[model samples]
Target: MTDMRNGSVTLLEVAPRDGFQSIDKLIPTAEKIAIVEDLLSAGVSRMELGSFVSPKAIPQMADMKEIAAHFKGREGCRMSVLVPNGKGASLALEAGYPDLVFVVSVSETHNRANVNQSVAQSLDQLRAIVAEAGDGGSRLRVDLATSFDCPFTGDVPLDAVRKVAGEALVIAPAAEFALCDTTGRADPMTVAHRFEAVMREAPDETVWAFHGHDTFGMGVANALYAYSAGVTIIEGAAAGLGGCPFAPGATGNTATEDLQFAFEQGGITTGIDRAKLLDTADRIAALPGGKTASHLRIVPRGRAV
Candidate 1:
């Protein structure tokens, strides 16, 4: 059964990284920093702040280094950046970040297209990153992307996700594993069933995370299902920002405000201030093309002009 207690569940805000990357407008460094600061003040402990991918591919994240520099002295925040390869990993380490994250698609075709590397190649790189992180203040995590379904490949087999997850466990024994529904193709049933099955396989030494896209509007439902299935860490983006530029017709992520409201209303305490989160979402919506995917618009404190 899913654990829905205070200490049992954790949410990793992904708006700064996954959410902003998919947008066409360039979110200035100051604004990104301000948003993250707001979330931290609202009591979000862990957040995916940025990605270390090639600037050419994700121009939005090109300022990763600069942003990392800004957070150098911050406290009580576990900031992480997504690293695609050895180079990206090295950059993360050089930035003095204590945590690094890697993502690999469960679908072979999507893995190649997204990262220009095969599953094995990506796994090898992750292993190298783990080795480099060796006994430091930092930690490594590998997100098993497309665990639900792939845009390129119709349905990803559970066995395939398990296979790669197993291999990843060997390299980074202490690494956390995240099951990503990159295409938002996961339903509540699939989430509950598959996640329960996969959670059983997760090594006791590792933590488990769930990253669900809201492509089909099932993100929150799937998240609730995962929570019931023993997933502790839930990933979400602010303003539901993010979609694959290369992946056609891809939608944004599950909105942070909406998810927080759902959790709170469901009698689940996420230790987050819902009102503050809504305010943040509203601010983002005011930006150019910033109308977020969240429904908590027109907050009362501020005038809605």
Candidate 2:
């Protein structure tokens, strides 16, 4: 049975990382900082501010180091960065950010396409990262990419996802876990089932997160379902600006504003100001060449537009 617990949820604002990385045009570092400041002011307690990947691979994230430097050790906000491989994890640890997110695909094909490695190889990388983060902050997390559906292979089997997740738990037992719908093809039924079954496996885990995209317009619904299934952390990007550049046809992430609105309506506490979040969404949407898909950001705000 699903928990359906609606007391509260942590919303991880991911515009600075996931949302910005998808845009083609370069958003000046100053602008990026400004956006982060705005997000913080909106009472966003946690966020994914950047990634520790190669500059050549992702030009938008080339300034990740500087961004980390500026926000390093800030109290109150739990800022994390995507660390794909061992090298990235090493760099992040050296840069004073032992907290990291290591992503591995449940689908073999998408794993090879996203990080140019097999699933086993990615797990090996996770082991190395876990070892590096052994005694420190140990904020390591495994993002089970394509946990629900994969663009290349279509719907991924839940057993495959569980196998990979089990291996990941063995690699980093104390680390957090996030089930990612890489292609946004997941429906509420699958979301509920996957999280429930996985959560049952780790009854002690209270920090499981759900990362979904809005490709099929079920982003909010899927997230709410995950919440019911006992997920605590919900990842959303302002303006819904994000997609897997590696996953063909995938769209932006579940919008932060939409999630807040849906949960707030049910009296779910997120500690975010709706007006400020909407304002931040507007700023993100105005970015040149930035594709957005949040319904709240577009609708009339008292006919002010």
Candidate 3:
């Protein structure tokens, strides 16, 4: 794993899971597979394809197993799925997903609303899940949602975020920690300071990533700040598709295309083909009720603004 803190960055494409989960319309399984294929073809190596939660909770992800089957045994791509609990982890195991993302919100109110568990209770459940996956060859990634701000509780305290992240590391020492801007309310300075604080509090080898939303149009800026503050992995959605169904005032994630453009323009390599990525963004936007918040997607590539 290259140190993202050193300058090299990796963008984890989260559209298939985070994006699709929020859509009201059910996208066909084949269409979902096609989009995943296009993303891979466009040089996106890491992707969150779907989640393993109950269909009733997130009907949009009902086809998780089918979607997993389509990409089974794929090589050269790091595929992951969001698992909210032990049952979700078991489902992902059965579906053959190797990477699982477990979310624990920093806000007590948001955690209760999102998963019906307090932070302590969720960590207990997460510990059990990690134990159950012992020697199963599955890797876990813990995401701290509302790490910066929460809709229900306004600004989250830095200590609260650090505590959750520290405890999460104890449960899965090798787990990657993603500091999420759930509502896109994080400013650049705050983002830099908080991330620096997290790195200091957590294990030196712990991989830190950023997941930002574009609700307030600061998604890209916040991400750049995160990168400068030593975060290497950044997660985003194709065509800016995302939002928390359980979160009030939540909106789309930073557009993957836009992030790639920003990184490349700053002389940072993301290994994504700009032209191919743009084409894939168009395909994503063509889906039913699909739209993008990527500025580069709307602007011509060669045109000087």
Best candidate according to lDDT: 2
The per-residue C-alpha lDDT of model 2 at residue 272 equals 90
Which residue ranges in model 3 land beyond 4 Å of their true spot? 1-6, 135-138, 299-305
Two-way TM-score contest, 2 vs 3, winner: 2
Q: Return whichever of 2 and 3 wins on lDDT.
A: 2
* Tens-digit lDDT string for candidate 2 (1-305): 22343588899998998899999999999889999999999999989889999989899999998888988888888888889888888888787886799899999999999999999999999988888778522598788999988889898999998899888887888888999998999998899899988877774753699999989999999999988877889999999999888999899999999999988888788999889988888888888887558888666566632
Candidate 2 ranges with C-alpha deviation above 4 Å:
1-6, 300-305
lDDT of 3: 0.87
Q: Model 2, 135: alpha-carbon shift in Å?
A: 4.0
RMSD of each: 3.0, 2.1, 2.8
How good is model 1 by TM-score? 0.92
Model 1 poorest 10 in a row by lDDT: 1-10
Q: Which stretches of candidate 1 lie over 4 Å from their true place?
A: 1-8, 135-138, 298-305
- Between prediction 1 and prediction 3, the one with superior lDDT is 3
lDDT, residue 48, model 1: 89
lDDT of each: 0.80, 0.87, 0.87
